[model samples]
Target chain A: MAETVKLLFSATRETVYMVAVSVLIASIFGIPLGVLLYSTDRGRILENSPLNKALGTIVNIFRSIPFVILLIMLIPFTRWLVGKSIGTTAAIVPLSVAAIPFMGRLTETALREVDRGVIEAAQAMGASPFQVITKVLIPEALPSIAAGITITAINLVGYSAMAGVIGGGGLGDLAVRYGYQRFMLDIMLYTVAILVVMVQLIQVLGDLVVKYLSKHR
Target chain B: MIRIRNLTKVYTSASGTVKALDGINLDIEKGDIFGIIGLSGAGKSTLLRCINLLEKPTSGSIEIDGVEMTGLSPKELKEMRKKIGMIFQHFNLLSSRTVWGNVAFPLEIAGFDRKTINEKVENLLNLVGLSDKARSFPSQLSGGQKQRVGIARALACDPKVLLCDEATSALDPETTLSILKLLKDINEKLGITMVVVTHEMNVIKQICNKVAVIEKSRVVEQGTTFEIFSRPKTQTARNFLKSMFICEIPEELKAKIKALNGNLAEGRVVKIGFFGEITAKPILSEVVKKFGVNANILYGNIDNIQGTPFGTLVVQFEGKNGTADRALSYLQDIGLDVEVVEIG
Candidate 1:
């Protein structure tokens, strides 16, 4: 049991690293992608239907591929990116790729929820495209965006468990090897229980941040 | 001066093309409180939007101070819009921003330094009489207060032309009057050229120096309020002018007149509209004094709009003889809009 606890501690660290890195990287690419999706809509700020469609297709393609299949398919690309395909960093490649499109679509939905009248008012005030995005779109959608980010982070936590298929060191690997293959039900239960706690903590923390950001509150 | 010539806007959609404005031409002089009045979907809003290039014109040109806006590039157009401020029926104040923040947004976009932005926002807040609510979010304010914030936000950059789209339609009657008064004050003090779009007759009558009536994407009539009130040439203008004021006869008085007249068709209830210098001319007493034709003044509405006195009276002539004709002709000769109504 002491050895099992030791292995669980290291697996937990690996799990946190993979999810945290994936979400951070996803945010870097996904935020701009989401803004592009919303702004390029016909009659919107950028107002280019062709650009919107092309980006939308790319997002859809990434989003539709099953996470398990995506992890297997990205192995060679992951090897080239991280110089290895069977470690925590290698797991980040597939995890972030899966996360990017998911987070981007959420961001698009959040931006779309902003009042169109507010946007027009900004334009009437002579706000340029960049000013409208930074000052109006993002700020107005902040609470919704926060909630979306929380959801995306929680989803990344679940997706990271799939990284264990490629010998990635995380809670999923411990659960599959020690608990499933070695028939230790206690280990599997412990990992699943910890994952649930992580999800709950993220959700509560997110709700608080969103509530605080809300001006109407 | 702002001049628009032959402007047209067509919305081509999957359904069909909607000609929002068809050849709308207007000239708003500096400091003129111009009104574009029409029913919903009559294209008054479209006309106002076209002025600032919020909706790009499919044809025609808009010239502000002799600079052609239609051909201006996007950057130039944006710079031009800095001189044109717009408010809306919904107020459109950002929910995420405080009243001060919302007001500061325009100035910030113009790249005003922090101190200048602070001073300008303070002055605008004072101008709109919302200094006490600077820290309040838009959702926490009343409708009138929210509108005041919207006005302040629009004025933050000290725009030369202010466009109001049904700015008072969302308020109560008392609130509407106060906001209208505020707008009039802003116009007079700042000398800002205001272009207002509204369907409320009182809104037009109370504030507008000049009005253009739009019908089916075309301006059917455009003139001073006094001219439109006194002589409406088009059927659409006449329809709008007829019921504009508080002209409803009290039910008790209508019944009393009907009882006294004894005959429904023969009762002489004339709805007389008088405007300009003629409202104070005492035309009714003149008819009574000259023809001795007992003119009973029953009900009327007298109002002073933009320093012009406009009146509508429901008068009962004692006798249904040709005296009514003479009186009407005399009234017409004196520049009064007179109509004979059959009262039963």
Candidate 2:
């Protein structure tokens, strides 16, 4: 029982580390990508349809790939990136790669929800395109974007569990090794309970932030 | 302080080219509350947008304060736009910002320091009577208050010209009046030139000193509000002005006209339109006493246009021996527009 507790603790730490680092990295790249995607859309501020389509296709291709296959498929790239093919640190490469497009698409949708009239009002006030994005579009879309980030982070939690399949240590690795392989039902149940708690915490925290940011409240 | 010469905007889409504005020329002197009035799809909005170069013209020249607008670079245009403020019909206040933040948005874009932004926003909120609502979000305000925020934001840069694109079209009648009053007050207080675009004649009647009537993408007529109201020159202008009065033959009057159709020997119905000092004169009484005719007023509407009384009256003149005809002729001779209404 004591050994199981220790394993669960380490597994949770690994999972948290993977999800947090990947979400941060994903956001850094994903936000600008999302803005570019929205700006290049038809009739938008930048308005380059071809560029929008190209970027959309790339994001779609990455998003459509199953996370399981994406993890295995990115093994070589992951090996090259973090100098290892299987570990908690190396799993971040595949997790972040898969999550970047997910975050980008979500961010783009959040941006699209911003009122065009508000954007025009900004432009009429002599706001440059950058100002329109930073001042008007981003701030107006903040609540929605924050909600999207929460969703992406929660999704990363799930993806990080899957990353534990091939020696990428996390709760999923412990559940597979101790519960499925060794048939320790108690160990599996405890890990499953912890995962559920993590998900619920993320959702509750996200809802709180969204409620606070929403002005209609 | 704005001159638009042959300003045309052509929009080409999948279908074909649409001439939103064609050969539009306008001269708005400084401090003038110029109105561009037209029906829906008449290109009044396109003309207003052209002033700020929001809608690029197909072929034309716009000069504001003697600087050619169409020739400016993007950076220069941005700088020039600082002097021109615009308020939209929807009261496009940023939903994410408080009233103070929304008003400060323009100042921030103009790169004012934090202290200056705060002071300007304070003065602007006071100017628009929204100082108490500074911390409130736009969603918390009524339509009039939202527009007041829009007005304050537009004035934050101390713009030389203010463009109103149906600024009050979204408000209730009482609210519209208050917004118009505020706009007029701003105009007088700041001496800022204003260009107002709207389809509602009442909007033009209430505030516009000069008006340009656009029809089918062309400037059908342009003149002082008094001129357009008192003496509409074009057929389009006449038709547009006709909508202002309740001149349609009422149901009861229609029955009376039908009854007295062919049997009208020494009686006739005449629709008389008079304006300015003419409305002050009791011309109908003069005609009654002079021509010995009994003038029965069936329908009438007297309106005040820019301190001038403009009225339309439909009267049935009845008498024997052509006195009724002489009465109408006399009303015409006295500078009243008298049109003989056919009883059919």
Candidate 3:
């Protein structure tokens, strides 16, 4: 039982590391990707139909692949990135890749929800195309964008747990190795309990942040 | 001065092409309050948009302050747009921003230094009477207060031309009057050329020195507000003024006069429009005394436009034949514009 507690603590840290690194990585590229996808549509700010269509197709193709399949498929690339394909850092590669398209599409939806009249008012005030995006579009869509981020972050947590299926060394890996394979029911229930608690904390924190932001709005 | 000549705009969609503006020729003098009046979908808003190149005109020459705007490059056009301020019917104040921030946006766009922006925005907030609500967000404001923020924002860059696209149409009547007065004060104090587009005649009567009536994408008539109100040449203008309930009688009264067939004094409804001296002259009483014609006033509305007394009255004369005719002729001779609505 003491060994289980020690292992659970270590496993929880690994999962936190994997989720945090992947979410940070996904946000860095995914936000720009989403903005480009939205702005390059025909008659939009960037207004490149060909680029928009190609980018959209690529995001859709990636988004359609299952997370488990994506993780398996990215093994070689993950190995090249982190020098090993079976550890926690390696799991981040597939997780970040899977999160990119998901975050992009969600951010695009948030941007689309911004009022067109507000965009026009910015233009009428002589805002440059870049200023319209930075000042008006982004700020106006911020509340919805914050909500989208919460949804994405929650999804990434679930995805991080799934990473343990393939020897990624998180709570799921501990549960599968000691509980399922070793016939230890207590370990299985403990991992599940911990996962549920982490998800609850994420949800509460996300809601509090969104509520605070919407209040200022 | 803003000169728009031979302006035409066509909008093409997947369904079909619609001509929104056609051959719209207008010369709006600097410091004058101009109005463009039309019904919904009559291209009034479209015309206003074309002025700022928000809705680019298919063909036209728009010259403001000696610069032809239609031919400018995108960057140059954007630079030019900074001088042409616009307020909307919806009061398009940025919802996420405070009233001060909303007003400061344009100045910020123009890249004015922070200190200059603060001073100018402060002066503008005072000008529009929203200084007390500077920290308040748009959602917290009433429609009138939101528009006051909008007005302050539009004036932030010290624009030479201000375009109001039905600015007062969204507000209640009392709020509308206050906004109109603010606009009038702005026009007087800043001498910014104003082009207002609205469906209401009272909006035109309140501030516009010159007005153009639009119908079916054409400028049907253009003149001084007093001239348009006193003598509406086109059926569209007449119908428009009829809505104001000031110039023309109600349709029921018109039908009633049309149905009656009697002597000139008994049946004829004469529309008497006067400006200047006749408004003060009690001309109707004079006509009654001179001709012994019992002039029953059916409708009357008098207004002071630009410090000039202008009014219209529809009266049915009930007296002998030659006396009523001579009385009307005498009114015309005295320079009171008279139109016989239902001739007996």
Number of the top candidate by DockQ? 1
Top model number, lDDT? 2
Residue pairs in steric clash, candidate 3?
Answer: B265-B317
True lDDT of residue B185, candidate 1: 97
Interface RMSD list for the candidates: 1.1, 1.4, 1.3
Most TM-score-accurate candidate: 2
Q: Each prediction's DockQ?
A: 0.78, 0.68, 0.66
Query: What is the docking quality class of candidate 3?
Result: medium
Ranking by lDDT: 2, 1, 3
> Model 1 — TM-score against the truth?
0.94
lDDT of 3 by residue, B1-344 (tens): 99999999998999999999999999999998999999999999999998888888999899999999899898998898899899999988787789999999999888999999999989999999888998988988999999999899988888999999999999999999999999999999999999999999889989999999999999999999988877789998888877865665667777667765353434457888878767887788888998898788877888786668877888787776577778888989999888888532
How well is each residue in B43-97 modelled by candidate 2, as lDDT tens digits?
9998998888888899999999999999999899899999899999998888888
DockQ of 2: 0.68
Position A117, candidate 2: lDDT: 78
Q: Write the per-residue lDDT of candidate 2 for residues A23-127, one digit (tens) a residue.
A: 999999888899999999988989998899999999999999999999999999988888889989999999899989988988899999988878887887788
Candidate 2, superposed: residue stretches over 4 Å from native? B261-264
Model 2 residue B82 lDDT score: 90
Measured against the true structure, the TM-scores of the candidates, in listed sequence, are 0.94, 0.96, 0.94
